[model samples]
Target: MASIFSRIVAGEIPSYKVAEDDRHYAFLDISPVAAGHTLVIPKREVDYIFDLSDEEYADLQLFAKKVAGAIKKAVPCKRVGVAVMGLEVPHAHIHLVPINREADMNFFGEHLSMQPEEMASMAASIAAAME
Candidate 1:
């Protein structure tokens, strides 16, 4: 069975797309810790981060760095925090979270919910910033 991340990449599941390249895809988290929490995943579905090839691993980080830059520009934050806890989904992924305080990146912290329209708008802004 394909993981949810694969489904999103395949367009079987819709996402608030932030940016994409031939090898990776980036989009906003529906259950975000902050206003601009985003997820970046490889196009090829691997169950663990360490399972990716050396080139794949390097490329993923490079792609994530670009997305994080866009997130910082689109959303107000002191820095963009990066996390790799490969337990939620059965696919290799990274979290790029916008944070002003250290506590903002708390994995166990409460998540924020925005309406569909708000999410769509935020995604557009982030995507634009990536350009």
Candidate 2:
């Protein structure tokens, strides 16, 4: 069975897309920790981060770095925090979170339940801010 990330990559699931290249896809997280929070994933679905090939891992980070920069510009934050807690989804992914403080990246804390329209608007803002 395809994981949810795979489904999103395949267009079986809809996402508030932020950016994408031939190698990777980025989209807004429905349960975002902050307004500009985004998830970056490889187009090829691998179950674990370490399971990815060397080039795949490198590309993922490079792709995320670009997205994080965009998040920083789009959202009011001290810095963009990167996290690779791969337990939530079966596919390899990275969380690029906007943080004004150290606590902003705390995944265990209460998350904001943003509406879809709000997510779309946030994604548009982030995409425009990408370097």
The candidate that wins on TM-score is 1
What tens digits encode model 2's per-residue C-alpha lDDT throughout 59-126?
89999999988888888889988889968789999999988788988788899999988998999998
User: In candidate 1, which residue pairs get closer than 3 Å at backbone N, Cα or C atoms, i.e. clash?
Assistant: none
Q: What is the TM-score of each candidate against the true structure?
A: 0.98, 0.96
For model 1, how big is the CA root-mean-square deviation?
Answer: 0.7
Tens-digit lDDT string for candidate 1 (51-97): 99999999999999999999999999999999999597999999999
TM-score of 1: 0.98
Q: How does each model score on lDDT? A: 0.95, 0.90
Residue-level error in angstroms, candidate 2, position 111: 0.6
